[model samples]
Target chain A: MEKSAGSVGKVVVDNISKSYDVGRLKEPVLDRCCLTLPAGQLTVLIGPSGCGKSTLINILAGYEKPDSGSITIDGAPVGGPSSDRLVVFQETALFPWMTTFENIVYGPTVQRERLRDEIEKDAAGLLETVGLREFRNKYPSQLSGGMQRRAELARAMINQPRLMLLDEPFRGLDAMTRELMQEYFLRLYEDKGQTSLFVTSEIDEAIFLADTLLLMSARPGRVIKSMPITLPRPRVPSMLTSTEYLRYKEEALDILHEEALKAFEGGSQAAADFVEAYEERETVG
Target chain B: MSLGATSTNAASNKSIPGQQVGEDWLYRAQRALTTPMPYLGIAGIAMFILFWYLTTEYFKLPRFVKLPGPVEVWTEFTNPDPIYGTSMYTFDYYKHIAWSSLRVMLAFALATGLGVPLGLYMGWKKKFKDYVFPIIEVLRPIPVLAWVPLAILMMPGREAPIIFLAFLAAFFATTLNAMLGVESIDESYFRASQCLGSTPWNVFKRVVVPGALPDIFTGLQIGVGVAWFSLVAAEMVSGEHGLGFLIWDSYVLSQYPVIVIAMVTLGLVGYVYSLLIRIVGRSLMRWTQKGQA
Candidate 1:
């Protein structure tokens, strides 16, 4: 199958606010969050821990209804989970019962937007692209963590969704594996350029992958800053020490530190770790 | 995601080589049969029989002097023309075995057919559970044998009462475990299916059924075992022809070796049933074995 480049329209999340009922208390997570993912761009959502990135992703994916506001793709209001917006979850959700090939074919096959034979052919192609052709018959549990995540990516891409939501897709992998996955994912994103909302807590990752970087506030999160990353395409590992990458990193870390302090004042231990982690990274660099 | 393929998911501590996934089922079965585990299991059974023989046959302790020894039971079991009519060589013994097997089979089938669907719906929908769970809670705790008097009163014949008693025992176990199985699945799978544009029915078919199977089979195993237990009790109370009836009749007639023979047959048949369930469960849940190689 030839690469189908860039068909998704802009995704506008307009003032989405959400909270959960905890006992008698109403705990707000996302506070009137607003952002725009431009067509065919990799938009990275970076925030401190507990800043409700997953909640916003959930809202965007239509898995949960926001308390107020709306999400639109090409002027169509997002009401519920649909094939148009697919999410690659933080924890691997490859349907442990299904083999890698089955999982990749699941979305299109279930949606009935394409024929089974066509989907199977495309799935076979995707398996080769993801380098999982040899492992296609294996179940999720039998594959390595990185392989599962890659299979998840293939599963989402096969749907050809207008928007892709990734919630820290590599959160738990070792640092080395995480970097390699990021590059591998970056290559796929560059080739297809699907409009994406990628969530992460790592500033370096955000700078490495984002065409447009979004920084969210502490708790009750909303977009506090949006900046365009002018780095060249086909990002390389050596960019970690480049002046341009470091510049983006410094700005992101500053905003993140301020948000961490806000959350710390609000008595979040997770924010304390967030602040300390960046500080340690600063000293080491 | 990784080209290396060496690192496995954290959920599985051990990873079987991918090549093993393609091994033929019959080859694997042959290997399993040839393993040392079965021989060790046989040795364990032999030791247990030896202990029984020492106590009841050779030692003749006061507590066991009346109890029939393993040798006496074995002799009657293998005898072509035994004195007692309830030996393995006799048609009467086969009739008892067949009756007990048929009742247990009927009870297990009825309970599983009704219980699994009810349990799945109960766990899937809050309204359904609210309407039904309280009734189950109140009725489940009542012992199976306790239902005998009411069952006999409600049902006309000896067969109906015995089967009803056995059904009640199996039903509670199957229902509760199937419910627990549905509840045990991670929430993310449901969410993932929704995002992938699966219909509500598809979610139930693709997610709910396969996800709950492991627990459903567990319930079936326990349910079948409990059904056998209650079936025997019901037979002893009201049965005219079954292994339980044979044992009771032997006791009354002072046919001590026949009672021992009936008891051993029950154990053997029950063991075979449990093993059959486990084999079926393993085949249905092939994915679960990927990490255990």
Candidate 2:
């Protein structure tokens, strides 16, 4: 595919905002969020549980639209879902009707007709790389959970898209299996190094996979902090206890904890202060 | 994306050698335990026949005395050109069966051809659904009998109206089931297809049709049953020769045994038609089996 080795998977978000009409009132979810995901590196979005992280990823994947602002992927403006941008859903979305081999080649087969044999060969190799060559013909129903996630990764990766959006792709696996998947994914990423936006609520996972981590605020979500991880390439779980990992984790946890508290408290003190100030100003006038 | 043979995605059809195979007696025992339905069914029928005989032939109780006994119907069915005659011969029985089967098949095929597309399109395209839904909702609830007069007036001939009635009976179930089938598909499949670069038409072909198949087959099975119900209704009203017509004509002639025979024939054929639909449904959807019983 001759993808440029560096600085090409860049994503720029310009003051994107979004809200949902949660029945009675429109609830603001993302408030004027701006982010620049540097090209050819892994960018992780992490936040409190209710921070509308999926909403942000959905917008970036072009499956959703923000209320305001814009997203550009590698200098091209993003719009509704295109092959250039793909999303890995939180729940496994591999078609159960399809075999591992069929699913991996689905994107390529459906997108274009020429070069089918070439794509088939690529799919076979991808299955091998992901350690699923033995399970290629099996239906998704037959594959173990971890194997299904790996097959999903192979399916997405085969497209060679400029930007990949993963929303909690490994959230449900056991801790051991999750770690293995992260490494398996990491190995694949190192080879391709495509620009990716990986969303997770877990701090350690973010630090392990991220080149740059964007810490998002709770409700009315937006980027509150950006931490650059300077860990050397080909990361490992052992880095979790290391001093450098601890420092980054501490800073992120601090910001995330503050946001979580603000959300939990409903920011009532600030609201109370505003009401009191309004009454005083009216009385003085 | 040019990957080579060295990294093969060769579909492994491997089963754990010893783990996959259970002992033969285990399967034999399972079969023995589970296949009791046929025997149970035969026992139930025999008991019902016994009750019928005891009440009608031996005891000669109330209304049972007036009703034809199992022996009388059995003898009449076995008779060659016997007295209780709709048509006088055994070949005439075959004729009635052929005619009714032909009618049911024609009406069922027509209903499936028309209804499945309408249902799928209604589910797929929202605007089309909005336009068509009011009429379907209003018309679907009206019983098939209610359509008989309009069908008789609107269709060209007796056969056409009769077929129309049969089609009407089957159409709603077929259409509604197919639509529900499409709706039942997980939204994730649609999203995945979009991410994989499927055109809307391609999505319909690959995802929508296959995903909705289980429901469509269900609709067909129900549709065939409904067709049988309407076919008889139409036949009683206007049919020249069918099982339903035979039942009515035998009643007029006071041939009670012939009427019973005609009723039984209808019941048996209706069952086999539905069974045929189920067999086809299972064969077509082998992918959905997951090898489960």
Candidate 3:
């Protein structure tokens, strides 16, 4: 509701670099990664394991500072975490002490920004939206993996953040559940046009939800490809098999395969077999 | 509800096997009751009592020649003015129980009151921990019994010394464990709390306190156990009208049966005290307990 036409919901990562000192050696994780996610777009970044995808999300969420670069959200410089930028962590980070409903209401209740009745109504709607109405009183540990992820989504969404940083938000969900969740997520964000940066390792998931698809290279990780997924909205399962989808998938896979080869840092038989086997597998779906 | 129909390749792999425990509650409880362990526990206690009786009285074994039998202790436990020099009838027995229970509760409550907040602050504030932790570490290792002399010298009255000793005994474990409780929290929870725009004070109240609860409960149980230990030791050495003094006085008079009565009474009371702590812990951590964790 607070959307400003020119500036709101835009994320600009400029020459951001980060490294962790392992003993005396500085292990470079992000190598001057630079990208701009346009306002109100869902951008997905896909890369091989340990390519600093999580680190990038953390930096964007203002949980960590880049070594020598700036990150701006909606023209304002990013500082330590604000309500405007919320992250859904990969690990089920729902407070173990709080129930699913309690977790969803935690943000506004803590900030005391809304009236009690408004918060209660919004919480009811959020729980309903995530299909967790019956599981409201259940603790995070009691919920199934998919349920926990949905609860976390509701928790983050209630904050109504300008930018949502999802660090593989659907990582461990069963494939069928993952598919359902993707559609559920797309439908939720479809009309809202909320800006989000989604990180993933799966190729299909990256293409399915992204307005802009950025394939990341191995660590020191950087954006290798910045292609747009021009697939039509309200995407059906059949579009996954379309020629345009396969064409986009093939180009993305080539970039990923090259990145994987580079990730290995040498000629390994497993790496060679991996890309070959991946390409040969029947259908992108 | 039927999200499992379309089996996923890697997606199914995301869920760790054996994470879900979907057994019926009644079935699980019935199954647990049917186990050999609970029956064995009851049988074990009966066998222990039988062994004590046989060795002391029935068999009159060489090792048990001097010790009082269970029968003698039981009889002496009821008599008003026993041969063992203890007045164990209605008023005398209740008086000792009341005194000891009163001292234990007061000391335990005081220790918890001071220890919990102290630990929470120490855990939350780095500067406070750095300044105080070394002193706490040094004092904790010195042992509560070792401080009996200092406690007596520090306080004037008999009641004050015993209470002081009990408080010190419980304080160290409660404080140290509460500190450890905060330290044990996962780093991600703190990050999550901060990202949600929680102020430092709110973080301390919401995240630090509740997050450290399970460990704090563990500390409370240990603290109460130590409080009993120190209370008895303090009463035994100094002038007092408590269970510990009764045990020592009976020992001095060589009233072995009365000593056993006091020991048994103390054991039953101490067991109940720890049980109370456990009951409180369960009620507080309903969110943690009902789940698999």
Candidate 4:
């Protein structure tokens, strides 16, 4: 795995703000949220629920446009979807009608401006890389959730995007499957060396997957902390058990914990009730 | 082998379900025979036929009131002209059956060809839906028979009403099904296609059509059934050479056997058409049984 001590490339986020129309009124989701995703490195965005981590990803993916700020990919203004940037959603976005092989090959086949034989070879190689070569003919529903994620990974990779945005890709997987998928993703990133921006709630996942972790605060979300992970390349699960990993995890957790408490106190009935119940139990103890 | 070992093997074999090799024709035959309705139906039909033969042949009732037995109907099927007399235009029962089947096939094809694409487009793109769906909704609830007067007024000839009625029967059911099929398709599939750089046309052709096919086929089966029903009603009014017309003409002349024959023909044609539609649907959606992606 290639290790770069300094920044790889520049991702400029210039005063981006977003608001959603909840019924008739506009509810502010992100207020001038400014953060850079270093190119050629994995950047993990962490925040409390409804903190606009997903909204940021959507803006980056060209699915949504921010009201004020602009996102530039390598100095070009991000306008809309292009082959240069890709997104892997938490849900398995595989086409139900297509087989695993077909789903993987779809990108190349549609972009048939490329040579057909070359596209086929690339898809086959990707299937092998994802350990799904044997089940290439199988449909998405036949595969386990982890395997489906692998297919989604293969489909996203087939396009060979410069920037890949993942929105909690392994959030719903069982613990064992989640670890397996994380390792798979690590290997993929190492092999492909593509810049990725991963949005996740799990502090450990952020620590493990990111070269830099961008922690954002609650609604009207803005980047509160940007912690550079000085962890070495090709970091394994065993590295997660290290003191450095634990320390980084604790730091991230501390930031997230503060945001969680703030969110709980700030007039959210469900959150307030939860915090009150917990405090009551603590006082009794 | 040891006695315990032998017993254990026997028990295991008993616990395991038996797998049949090749086609189990005997099992299928047994299942067919054991079906509750067919046995009861056969018994009821036999009793009816016996009563008809006894009452008509033995009682010697008035000729108009007392119809011929099943044997007479079968003989009329073999040599229809003498039994049905000159009033019935067709030489045999098979001729009328063939004519009705042909009309149904043509009408069904026309209805499906027109309805499927219109339904797909209406269901898929929201912009087109506002314009197209309202029109379909207005036209759909109106009965096929209700269209008869308008069809007669608008159409230049007799052929038009028959075809119009057949189209009416098929169009609404097929359109409804097609729209529903498209509506029910997993949206993620379309989104995935878009992400893969699929053009709108490719998405419709590859993703939308196939995803909606199971529902489309269901609509087609229903549409064909409705088409046959409409054909019968249409034929009664405007048909010159169909089973419906044959029934009407025979009833006018009081040739009861010919009327019964025409009724049987209509039922048989409807049954056969439905079976064909089902077979086609099953084959088309064979992959669905396996599972979704």
lDDT assessment of candidate 2: 0.82
lDDT per residue as tens, model 1, A96-207? 7767877787787668878767888888877877778988778898999999999999999888788889999999999988998898798778877888989998888888
**How much is A47 displaced in model 2, in angstroms?**
0.9
Fraction of the true interface contacts (Cα pairs closer than 8 Å across chains) found in each model: 0.67, 0.63, 0.54, 0.39
Cα lDDT tens digits for candidate 3, A90-165:
8888888777777787788778788867976888887887788988777788998889888888888887778888
Model 4 over residues B217-290: C-alpha lDDT tens digits?
88998998889888988999887888888888888888888887778777767876776676666544534546
Compute the TM-score of each model's chain A versus the native chain A and list the values: 0.95, 0.90, 0.91, 0.90
Candidate 2 per-residue lDDT, tens place, A91-160, comes to 9998766678878988887888549779888998899899998787777888889999999999999998
What is candidate 3's CA lDDT for residue B271?
A: 84
Which of 3 and 4 is ahead in DockQ? 3
Q: How far is candidate 1 from the true structure (C-alpha RMSD, Å)?
A: 5.1
Task: Supply the global lDDT for candidate 1.
Answer: 0.85
Per-residue CA lDDT of candidate 2, range B131-246, in tens? 98899999988988888889988999778988889999899989988888888889999999998899897788777887898999999999999999889988998889889899
**Pick by lDDT: which candidate is best?**
1
Off by over 4 Å in 4: A1-10, A267-285, B1-82, B85-91, B291-293
- Where does candidate 3 stray beyond 4 Å? A1-7, A266-278, A281-285, B1-37, B80-88, B291-293
